[model samples]
Target: MSVHFKKKAANAQTAIPTASLPDIIFMLLIFFMVTTVLRETTVQVRTILPQAEAIEKIEQKRLVTYVYIGPKKLQNNQVGETAIQIDDALVDEVTNVRTIMYNKLTEQPRLIVSLRVDESSEMGKVIDVQQELREAGTLRINYSSKRDIEGTL
Candidate 1:
């Protein structure tokens, strides 16, 4: 009795084709390039934001509307009173805050009002703004602050 072992012939090309790899990569690149969006928030007011040890990152900027609550930027090195800036206009009266904020809420239902209040700002002003926001049914508010300093001692 004779035992015979036969070997199978190998093909010239690979079993899996990689010819479409560049095409697939190109499509993916175009997909991400088109889907990527950059949102910009322009602040026209002078704000000296308070410092905080703990801070939360905002994931979606489209849902946020910045309300700068700080001292007014005056010329000739003069110190100005605390005021609120909505978009590009400097609104002196707290009463006007609601209408603007309400309008924003109408545009974006899930709007987050971020208060960039100064460290030296009066708590009363901040509270008043909060009250107005509450009246406008904008309960989603965020306080913007810088990272707190660490002590050597």
Candidate 2:
């Protein structure tokens, strides 16, 4: 005995429904919107980071806090002087750095302070920041720098 398939429908629907696509796209948009971390604070300070022979990429972005130290970017470089910036605020006194960093450390115990120091900035300022960090007990620090290329084509 032989079996045969029947195909005798003339008005049957054959096209796939397109109604769910917009909902799917909307869901994806919402998913990405929630997952992405928007940059809340803009880096207002001008820091020309020094060069280094070796460098490593940070694995965790959330575990890092940036401390900007440089000659304040102003209309005239001569008028404005070197300053320390934490988060979005400028620290008028160096002593405030320790308190701020200590608070941050309490919030995030594994936080690594990344110091972005300018190449032309005075070394004394950096030493001061380091001393503050040491007092704050934020010893796990990383110096942000560019890769040195002396004799490269």
Candidate 3:
């Protein structure tokens, strides 16, 4: 007798069971959103900071002292070129800056004095302030700068 061939039906595909994929991705996103650390940024009067070819990263938050330089009026009531202002008063000499900085350093020995001198400040004044800080045993000093988005120093 001639053999009769029977056609076999194709088997149906197994279910992928992808219902947990969205849940898994959503859980991961929530985990990262909760566990990620966001750094706190310093805010103050905006000033155009001098650019540096080499910039170093500041890892820790320490005590900051702002030294502002703006227009000043002499005893004669005549407005003169900007002078360094420490805590709102005019800093006519290095001694004033030194005394204020020294007091701050004493309170926080590990203070990182952030010098925010104006762009128009005299280089000599800036150096003088730095020298005084060095003399007062405040070695850790940072110059605040405005950074561009490209990450250029």
Model 2 Cα shift for residue 80 (angstroms): 1.9
Candidate 2 TM-score over all chains jointly: 0.74
Q: After the best TM-score superposition of candidate 3, give how far the Cα of residue 13 lies from its true spot, in angstroms.
A: 39
Q: Rank the candidates by lDDT, best first.
A: 2, 1, 3
For model 2, residues 14-64, the per-residue Cα lDDT tens digits are 898999999999999999997798887766678888888778988889999
Index of the highest-lDDT prediction:
2
- Give the C-alpha lDDT of model 2: 0.88
- Model 3 lDDT per residue over 1-153, tens place: 234566557788888989999999999999999777565433222344766646676666446566654445455544467567665455678777778888888898778877776666668867878888888778887786665556653
Q: Is candidate 1 or candidate 2 better by TM-score?
A: 2
Clashes of 2: 0
Q: After best superposition, candidate 2 residue 139: deviation in angstroms?
A: 0.9
Highest-TM-score candidate: 2
Stretches > 4 Å off in candidate 3: 1-47, 56-62, 70-80, 149-153
Tell me the deviation in Å of residue 112 in model 1.
0.6
Alpha carbon lDDT at 44, candidate 2: 60
**Sliding window of 10 residues with minimal summed lDDT for model 1:** 1-10
Of the two candidates 1 and 2, the one with more favorable lDDT, higher being better, is: 2
Against the hidden true structure, what lDDT does model 3 obtain?
0.68
Score residue 96 of candidate 1 by CA lDDT: 91
Query: Which parts of model 2 have CA positions greater than 4 angstroms off?
Result: 1-35, 76-79, 148-153
